[model samples]
Target: MIQSTDEGLMRLALREAAKGLGRTSPNPAVGAVLAKNGIILATGYHQKAGQPHAEIEVLKALSDYPSAKGSSLYVTLEPCSTYGRTPPCTLAIRDAGISRVIVGSIDPNPKHQGKGLAELRRDGIQVTTGVLDKECTRLNAGFNKWIISGRPWVIAKAAQSLDGRLTRPIGESSRLSNSHSIRMVHRLRATVDAILIGAETVRKDDPELTVRYGPTDHQPLRVVVTKTGMLPIDARVFVGEQDTIIYKDRSWSDVLDDLGRRSVTRLLVEGGGQILGQLFDNYLIDELWFFLTPRLVGGDKPTIGGVGVQELAGAPRLVDVRYLRLKDDLLIKGDLQWPKNPSRAF
Candidate 1:
């Protein structure tokens, strides 16, 4: 049995956890709330990797150490029992004199999975698990994927007309998304570890691909995958101050493998049809974000190119579909139904 109060507190914890999404790589964003007799005492969230976790943040935020005694703690993710970059959170929770713990999701890492709860129970503290489990799990999908598969979570995004045309037949660069959508794209870029594009996009668009709409501490690594080693010498990508990497004459798998090794937990792929085609062909895409405008551009240029599905059964489908209106444009985002390649899951 679960209480509405518990659900509400867990939801707040989840909201707090999301604040650290872009900043916490190689670590899941977690939030915590301390409450006594249905009254909230303190709230905190994890800020970055190798820093104090959510449990520590909440405990330290308390005005008095004795205030947390016999209070219930609600957390989006389980407390860690082992030390890595910081001290074990379970020990801290016990030391704080917390009487009960309500958790949203268990630790995804095998080494710490369920161990935290076991240690707390051994100390005679009451523990409740799986409060808003689905939401908690989805919040850290990128971290979970990176932890389990040793690869980044791939997000394929594009802006096309209603008729599915990326640009004019001449392949000239044009703005299909509105000002609001462009801002949204910039915000999305801030949350990812890297931005990837095909060679053709570099030659045609010559995009700088920096986060300009809002404030970001660091620019994501710019990546370009090219079959041939030829590219414009003065492309903006090359001239930009941000770190850039060119994968000339390399397979998509090789590029992803190297990026994974570099600890890129979330990768955004902005495309020029051919690059998107390669991703789709390789079944490398985990999520899709398409901005569809009201106007239709009837042309031979499709949003995605490459040998597409020959039969209806072979076509890919999206799950957990979401549609949002960004000004006049429609943003369609969803996860792919099929599992990504286990070898190169980025």
Candidate 2:
């Protein structure tokens, strides 16, 4: 185990690494920090694909530091030693005169994996692994999932009333989540590669569905699912110039396969209940974000419309549930553990 002080630096590196969540598809987000004499000299993270890796950026930031030799480097993922879109990060670190390296998680990409660490050691640099490793793994869940399973990690988000009603009435458009919770949902959208919704949601709410909470140059692609391809051109979803996709009666497998081929690492499903059910029916959802509002919409209201299971045992179960209070709203988050796919079980 690394010292607690070094572990703390690794945690900072991991946090910086997640800033590239939506931008770095087909590339694992990595963060690197250079420290000397118990002080962080500079920190950098992989911003997007087809660009320099974290170690190179950090080295460039620290190049002007006087007497920077023997500075230690802390990186969230193992540095790549082989060339691809950019030069090897290991070469940059060595040239920057970093003497020791600490890695939070080992890279599993086919090009590097264990070879990056081996290359660093061959160059007579000190190396330590597994510093804040669990958190680092969670940070790279989508990238790792896509690397192995060929499907983006799906997260389904729903906000319902205290009585589980998705809305007060069937035809009316009303917001169930508070302002705080709504922004939380938008932030989630900003972090994923795409946001999916059913045609009914667009027809009813006409939401802009753009990221308005934080500084973001890129927007998540908007995807609409419909039984037919017919949609109003004047709808609010089409008002913006962002890329949008419509799928007519496409199987969940087909949609997922297409996204995987595009290297989409993460997807967010903002549901109108039936869409969530459709994903569940196809066994595609991987995580669940259920928020319960403070108010109760109890009198003959539609509660989770069109969601059903033939038998009790068929319902998807939430494991590792964590509860928190967002203002007055109750937030429940967990892993959506589905039955294993028989064909892929082995």
Candidate 3:
């Protein structure tokens, strides 16, 4: 029973929810709206973990508005039926006396799978789903991957010079790509669950790894994988309210378990080659997003690690490839398909 205007507003809410992307790690980006008599009462987007979710935020913004009892509630994801850091959103919807519920997507987590819909139906609310399936799923892909696969979707990112070098030379400060591409990197950061880097990249680049586009309301979890856990405690990435996790000499299964326990479902690996190599060697990479600049730096620096002769001899193969043109750069994306218990390719 979605009207044209209702669908348009739902799109707006989805975009609003996307704004919460880089910030609401360990929590899904969600948006909600309260509507009655074809009039919008309130709207909200989930801002961060431990804060009021989208539904709760919108209800609070309504603030005892007398006519909310018969309003319809529209949300980007199924209202969560379980209590975690906050109260169950299903309970909030029921308490509001909403006459109808429309959800963009369902929660893929087994614990809450279909439970939210069941709860709403049991409470005599009319519930409809799949209003904007594709956008909603895209927004919560990280959450779905973590819930269904026990590991976050891996996103490999890199910035190289015109000649495909990460840097001019070791320990040298040189620009690798243009400002537009760098801004796109920030946009990518604004949408992922977390940003990961190797200890060497942290020590050498000293990146802050915070989202620099739009608002600064929330930051993604900053993660570092180190063999010796040698990252400096005083690094700038540690100064923010963003949660940080360090994986040290742990098996891939152990790392996935830890991230699952912490509710991280999507992870971005931004590296200095060596870290990328290790992930590839372990057959842990799921997706690759490569930005190929038009210029070239014909230096001795490596492009991407784990692509050498020994590594490629038995490495995982690319199952899918897509091309995107961004100004002068070409974005090459691939899906990695690793064999069962594949040997260490590197």
Among these predictions, the greatest lDDT belongs to: 1
Q: What would the TM-scores of all predictions be?
A: 0.93, 0.91, 0.79
Model 2 weakest 10-residue run by lDDT: 337-346
TM-score of 1: 0.93
The TM-score measured for candidate 2 stands at 0.91
What digit string (tens of lDDT, one per residue) describes model 2 on residues 1-346? 4766898888788877988878887888888888886698888888999988888778767758554579889999988899798988888878767889999888767768889899999999999999988778778888888888888899988888888767556666668888888878877787788888889888877777788887567788888889977688888778787878888899888887788787778888887778877677666788888889988887643434455656777666898898978898988988776655553311
lDDT of 1 by residue, 1-346 (tens): 5777999999999999988876788788899999999999999999989999999999989988899999999999999999899999999999999999999998879989999999999999899999999999988888888888778889999999999878754565558889888998998898788999988888878899889888777578999887777888889988767889999888776887788888888899999888888788778888899999988878677888878766667667899899999889999999887643354343
Model 3 residue 240 CA deviation in Å? 7.0
lDDT of 3 at 172: 74
Q: In order, how many clashes per candidate?
A: 0, 0, 5
Ranking by lDDT: 1, 2, 3
Lowest summed-lDDT stretch of 10 residues in model 1? 337-346
Taking the tens digit of each residue's C-alpha lDDT, what string does model 3 give over 215-311? 5555678988889988888887777777888889887668766876777777888987887776766677777777777776676666567654354
Give lDDT for model 3: 0.78
Error of 2 at 78 (Å): 0.7
